[model samples]
Target chain A: MAAPPPAAAATTRTGALTVGLSPYTARTSAFRRAQICRHRLPTLRCRRAQPLTAAASSSPVFHGECFVVGENIDTDQIIPAEHLTLVPSKADEYRKLGSFAFSGLPSAAYPTPFVAPGEESSRYAVIVGGPNFGCGSSREHAPVALGAAGARAVVAESYARIFFRNSVATGEVYPLELAEAGAWKECKTGDIVTVDIGKAVMINHTSGKEYKLKPIGDAGPVVEAGGIFAYARKTGMIASKASA
Target chain B: MTMTEKILARASERASLEPGENVWVDVDVLMTHDVCGPGTIGIFKKEFGEDAKVWDREKVVIIPDHYIFTSDERANRNVDILRDFCMEQKIKYFYDIKDLSDFKANPDYKGVCHVALAQEGHCRPGEVLLGTDSHTCNAGAFGQFATGIGNTDAGFVLGTGKALLKVPPTIRFVLDGEMPPYLLAKDLILQIIGEISVSGATYKSMEFVGSTIESLNMEERMTLCNMVIEAGGKNGVVPADETTFKYLEGKTSVGYEPVYSDAQARFVSDYHFDVSKLEPVVAKPHSPDNRALARECKDVKIDRVYIGSCTGGKIEDFLAAAKVFFASGKKVKVPTFLVPATQKVWMDVYGLSVPEFGGKTCSQIFEEAGCDTPASPSCGACLGGPRDTYARMNEPMVCVSTTNRNFPGRMGHKEGQIYLASPYTAAASALTGYVTDPRDFLM
Candidate 1:
């Protein structure tokens, strides 16, 4: 691995601060005093890390143009329930993934949004729909399937309340609000848009309009790393040393 | 701007938005059932790789409601796969048709997550919730924002615990006058959807207001909120109040907490409706969006009446059907089947109070009539159940069902026409064998 960057080392030291490592020791191993003396910072203070801490994760950040769609698309249309059974394994191994999962996607994959059984579609990372994006049952698999298809966020006129929360609770999908879809008509699916979760901002390249949104409660870490799983791993490694 | 736009704006703390944007938002809870989990697992593996741990498995929920009985070998395999996956993941909440201790562990499991969450406490006022099914919006009855997603979304949430959201315009359904007796929210929503067409309110938030809405019980309001999607709205909101809190009290985990819209809460566009003057409504076959009055096309003949679904399987809905059936006493022209949404509902109506399956208690009235014979309490052949199929192609078989949709082939063959109505109307039709309105029987 490449040598850790100064910023990366600084963050590591800050992380160690919460678990009770002295800043001096955090800068260098106890057995390596010369190295520790060279890197120790005098001003840093140790304190318990904040609950639901935010961290940079390895997941890729999605920022590009934007797209839009109409509303009230039911779960069946997203990833039809009938198709749920065709996956190769209970664990999803040996199955074709991506836009092919749903009938809808760029033509490059499945080429058709509605295919007979055994057909698939291309996958899109972001789906910008009109209001009531998910307005059906309490099926968590909807968002899960959407996430697995590579959707990082769903910018819509609005979300079904249940779908909105479920998306966040499970996959950390960004539920951005577009008061109206006028700008959406100007955009199309696959259009790139910049989604900055830290600022809760979405800049539609097509319209040049910037929209603000609500962040997941204490989800800064999850969004920064592109999602929660990435954050958990980083947190797990840090917590391990504290235990030791 | 429409009512959907305004409702979204009021709920929004962030700046105004345009479609095609993305941003993160807080998610109060995540819910899933086994009906479509296998698809999610498949996608998770493909995208994140097999070795990745399911992040935040505690927040994840999985229930085997769709084919809990496993009608065939393929179905059984589906259930088995989910069971094994949950075991490997060490998932905490798993409910089978036979083992339902988790319901009580909830201290207030109303049945399905849509209703159960509102009753149990996972859905709080002014919060966002998502589920894999359309009825997930039922929590909106409690003033929380809720909607349904799909399997891809579910898979992502399960793997990463994140989701994307979009803001929508708002459409206001203003109500006036009194709700006709026995008319209930189901009938009213059918009327609204008919006026707006199946996709009329597409991509918008529906804020139900007016004296009529204000007067409804939480159960009735939930019926309205749950069907917002049937009309194509993203989500529906009922401002919390005394009735809201009162209904939520004792029945849910977050009991007696009052919530409401701000006095200066914003709105998009508002429309008005007079329920008292409304007639019994019906949606023609092949589309839940195709609606008309029961009297406009009473000439249509019928073959079956299905009275059950998350929308129509509630105790109140059951009671409504029973009253209509008992009063008529005479079994009419068409065959009828009552499919409850969950086993608990089946037991509630059958009068069997067993403690093992959520609530062992059954509804004596229904049980006495052999109501539990439908096999399972979910989307069972309701999507194509045998009892509710069309006799022949081009044959007119009218069905009064409490199920959410009335699309062609939804119950059986696509050629047959299906009429959507409340349990009351369903029971009435089951007796008359022809299209009959509940009001006609009342007099």
Candidate 2:
């Protein structure tokens, strides 16, 4: 598949700052303050409050420090049922859900946490996770929370069907599969990594190593269009916003 | 073609379908409950316009189940959203609970959406169902293509009356031989999840066949299909047979064209199990795939026994639990909480008398065994709703529950340990205060 153009639809939808940036380009010149109004990654160190929120889309490339997690990270661990009461459709509740993302993961095991206490968004731009990453419940809030938390993408060995679909359907995160299994085992949380969706490569800058990713195939176009709704409008499969 | 392929083809108006091919299909029924309904409704209004009506009011089902009885203000308010949507659209099936103070006052109340779906006849063969909740796969027992979708997909379906779906390759499980009296469908599913691990069937369809599945009744078949999500399966189905036809007789007047897998059907893989040889089992703490036979875990003590959920809290589940409680003639060693799946099952516990027990109701037997009165249904404590949900694990106590999924913190407390067991094993464990085998009482 070819590289996606800048995500105008996504930018307007969530006001997220991810520009699908190129890792090779100099940040001072190519990377604008991206202002990242909301959902900026914890690693971006954006001090500005009330930033835009949106995830890393398939608009070619984006890189950031990773948030590492273990196997069987079910939806409960992603966004616990208690917090599921907050609807993702409403902007305020969507942000509230992000604050509580990964609240269900046992605190003893995951001491660092996905969203720090009293913090609105995560510092990590991407999630490096193990197998069965989003197992258990079919709550779409799991991915929506991560995207709302400003996490752009997830690289995992495997994913639950519903979680995978929800990620693509919401266009919240780039759910990528690792071609080199257990690649995440070598990296820890806060490891800087660059994801090139066009080339299907994930470069771990902290380790100075690069890993391969499985092509997302047919689902790629839908995600790039900012989920099924946008894709439907784009392809004329459904009526456009103006007509509706 | 596989049954799933056939169903998809029929829904999509295609002559054939392959596993990887994406196609658009008409959604027969789209069910949502309080937990996900508000979000789904919000999205529908946002995308389809505030004044836009659903594609078909009759095809949308709103059941207030997950947070129905909770006192949490937001959870309570979610139901009101569904009420307003149903009222505005004039939806055909809106199982609303108007009186939280008295469930009896609301005759339309149905506890769990999945079970209520079967009871209310929203589930039919050769049809397609997409719900906001994952357990929507529970409707696949009638040989339909039923699977769970996220609120986004459901919202889109609500507005468009169709969804883009990929046909999943089928994995056939042939369970032959007679089921032992002590064994329940819960044990069988636990065994499958154990062997296949949870992700074994990911992005695939699981089709059940053979003598053992044939011998099972409609409710038992539902139990098998309900946990397909646990295996990461898109759906699980049993071919529509007399049992399914009989169950649908009074439930729906709408005629459905039930389809069967062709003789030349191709399966991705196949598994065979002899139900007679399979022992009662449980999925222990933090994972549904962590399986251990009931007898193998007999030394592990527990603090509670909960019998409920779309997976196990049926009329038959209560009957099976009562059988053990009656046979033991002993008081429960720990707190044994009973929750029927739906209001009808609750009514059954109180109204229906067991013939083998000489006409004593399950409630009588449960009371005689020192168990808590069967609690009002509505998915109580299954996913650990608001802190006040009935029978929710408030502490880090070990529990033997008939419900599905032992994922950490699933019931309530993050440290709580859960053992997923059948009603028979759950009852016997309640008597022994450990993971006791039902054969000890059943035999």
lDDT by residue (B26-145, candidate 2, tens digit) is 999999998899989987886788999999998999999898778898888888888998999999999989888878788999889999999999999999999988889999999989
**Candidate 2 pairs with clashing backbones:** A37-A51, A37-A52, A38-A51, A38-A52, A38-A53, A39-A150, A42-A122, A42-A123, A43-A123, A56-A152
| Cα lDDT computed for each candidate against the true fold | 0.56, 0.85
Q: Looking at every candidate separately, what fraction of the true A–B Cα contacts under 8 Å does it contain?
A: 0.26, 0.68
Compute the lDDT for candidate 1: 0.56
Candidate 2 segments whose C-alpha is farther than 4 A from its true place: A1-36, A39-58, A242-244
- Counting clashing residue pairs in each candidate, in order, gives 128, 10
Candidate 1's DockQ is: 0.12
RMSD of each: 13.6, 5.5
Give the distance in Å from residue A210's predicted Cα in candidate 1 to where it truly belongs: 32
Task: Going through the candidates in order, state the TM-score of chain A alone for each one.
Answer: 0.54, 0.78
Name the candidate that leads on TM-score. 2
